[model samples]
Target: MPLPHLLRRRAPRSGARRTARRLAVTVPLVSLAGVLALTGCANRERDAAPGAGTSTTASSAAQTAAFPVQVTVPGTDHAVTVERRPERIVSLAPSSTESLFAIGAGEQVVAVDNQSNYPEQAPRTDLSGYTPNIEAITGYNPDLVIASNDTEQLVASLEKVKVPVLLLPSPHNLDELYAEVTALGKATGHLTEAEDLVRTMRSDIDKIVKDTPKPAKQLTYYHELDPQLYSATSRTFIGQIYGLFGLVNVADAAGGTGDYPQLSPEHVINANPDLVFLADTKCCGQDAAAVAARPGWQSVTAVRDNGVVALNDDIASRWGPRVVDLVRTVSDAVTRTAQQG
Candidate 1:
């Protein structure tokens, strides 16, 4: 699902660098695996999936070790331990929810935040990741809760009730994203499946980057978060994906302090990016035509050459398995632009 209308354009709550790193952007389909050797993101030694010829004793030991897994929360020194495989999991972060379902832990999810609308089968509830209600959450009797933030002292509150919470924040890069997947897998006892998913994702993304045609003249782009011209810079996570294709982000030169910067229409027109990626299709009803109709935007190079791309809000907003799809979409657009040139 698209971010809540009010939050669709809000910057991150942290410092400038982190703030700039979190803006939603167009996702690519057919995703990446640049480094497969990262056993687990939290520094835990991962045992390989038992071979078919492995002894039963070894397999049993592997299964035993899968539990009592400990994962360091992303961007923090503190770690949370999953004492046992979580049977009743409640996910408050949409990205984490998607990761759980993708890693084969769907059946273990007892409930998910309302924003976790993908997978369709996720037990969608009225629970809010933002401003969570302690009573409503504890009522579900969840063994584990995964959220993006500790909003309203949620972690402390849950701890008071003896419920374990895993804080998986928005990743700063692909490596961090993979680590989150690894962490979730370990926490849920699906480490092997998670490793497999990471390998596939890495392989797919690497292929997409290598196969896409690189334009002779490097293409420049503008990633629109909304009609108001809020944009993501090259320093952001989505920006790194664009960097894979050698696309330049005009927002970087717009003199904004963070990853998600609100650019003046004048700066965009002056930069006149070769491509305009709209991430507000679902939230704000924007499209190529709407962009062309904007005051002075018709003169933008992207508009004149039909280079405006409308991205799926949900896919663009979440960094998960579907990132491969987002990558594919960008690849197709880059191919078209190169062909036109």
Candidate 2:
């Protein structure tokens, strides 16, 4: 099975260390894999406001005013100066593509990496974000390029060609995510729409947390990244999402070294968490039945009591607007489990 980019390990970099202090609340330093996962993307556009098209001129002006703006990207020391509103943009990361479209900058995007399949209308290209080819990327003549990971070579090559590159790494928390969305808006001359998008997302997520009653007792959950028992700890962005519902991560005690840790089947069975969330439904073809079929896993409380939640690999992995959908799904599951008990 193709390893989900979210789970793949990446080389350590200076940016990871720079963000460490700001992310003190999160456990384990953010790894390239953790950053990659938080920054991936998939389909489904958020509903736009009525008459949204009517404000194009006004929105563009506001974006221009905000332009010649110098914004520092998260997880890096480099600051990007947007000399003017970008007219032609290329997105190398799926999350970046999704954000551009969500904030009404879709029309500005000239091309997107091969992995950006979301919205069904993104100008998909053969460009590889993993092995960025400056030649193919520059061929589009993009005035601006947005990416997740800032590999030195990739940035240097793009800069050498005079293309401005903005690195938006995986956010350590919700605040960083909001900042990223705002930054994208400023870059694309869609600041008004981006602010609206962020506001709506915050309101929706807040409502979900407020309305969803916490379990009578703490519920233990096992979030499966893959079928092999690799899981995210509470310190991870995904783990933080689960944390909102007061769900205790069983992998927190697995003594794993990093944000993404591979747990042993025996260790999981021993814990027998109350709920199991499978983020690999699409990638690994894992479902409640498949999990139940694993030896000794049949006895796990979540498996025996029908508490397995199959999630869309994309929504579960990406830290984009669809995160509301992921949280809502988890809230519903927790509510059901709480009521059942």
Candidate 3:
């Protein structure tokens, strides 16, 4: 689920010139949110209680809403059938684990991959670690398995063993994110709830679109992946946030690497972004402004104006329920900067 793995580095420590620009960096825990949890035998409630209720029909609606389906994920040969609502579930990705928890199915999740720490409860649950331990997962006796792009092999074996697996294709942008959330919600028999969340999320996005203070000029921004000045591609999710606010990513015009591409200070100096967004606060000793203050950055427009904005690493990145906050934060940054401009 680590769809984005930009190298982690230190950010610039210097503030930049005044400009209306915004950058969004989701939490560092996001990747753990991506490919996090795993499972084991000891913690399975089904095993603890003999003959646990296998009532596929927890209710008439649940039974009807849940059933078998063949879902084809990206980079896979064929669609696979998911037998039911997955009374016992295993999450092989941190994002999938976070997604399940967001939809209220955390209890149904018997295990998760390693690194899924945000929902600390997930780690506390039985875990098979980063990789799949078929025996351990089998011991927990999960009805369904959720696998990220990297874990397709595990999914294959689970399929051979007759265990249903949900192949979760990694999302590239916000639209795909909406689709994944809706898909997972439906798969989990929480379609209505998921749809409702989508509606609310869209509403938040719409407000950002509408209420965004019209700037007289398109402000330029740079999203630092780490302490390093490496920038995100224009096609990336975080890059799209700047676009949504009608701001410019200097890298966009320069043609970003379409991924987090580390660049020389000379590159940033030439791009001359008006705003600098750091991926984190100083809490962990990672500072964005300091990066801008490095020897060659002194002349950049952003460095002169104090336009460096530190963001919450998690909320800024995730496309889940917290996306509302992403839009809000972006909109606020845009509006705040626009007013000052």
Question: lDDT for every model?
Answer: 0.72, 0.71, 0.56
Candidate 1 at 125: error in angstroms? 0.5
Candidate achieving the largest TM-score = 2
Write down the TM-score of every candidate: 0.84, 0.85, 0.75
Candidate 2: residue 252 Cα off by (Å):
0.8
Off by over 4 Å in 2: 1-52
lDDT of 2 by residue, 1-341 (tens): 01122422122222333223112211121211121222232111223344554456666776688768887866568678889889899998776687788877887899998767765789999987766888899999999998876654888888887888988777766777788888888777777777877887788879988999778889999987666677778877778888888999998899946666678999899998999988767657889999999999999999998999997666666566767777788888899998987
Model 3 Cα lDDT, one tens digit per residue, 208-260: 67988976778888776555454566566666666777777665555543355
C-alpha RMSD of each candidate structure in angstroms? 6.5, 6.8, 8.6
Q: Pairing residues by index, what is the TM-score of model 1?
A: 0.84
TM-score of 3: 0.75
Question: What is residue 247's positional error in candidate 3, in angstroms?
Answer: 2.3
Q: What is the lDDT of residue 146 in candidate 2?
A: 89
Predicted candidate 1, C-alpha RMSD: 6.5
> What is candidate 3's local distance difference test score?
0.56
Write one digit per residue (lDDT tens) for candidate 1, span 154-231: 999999998999987666678778888888888887777688788878888899889998898999999876676767
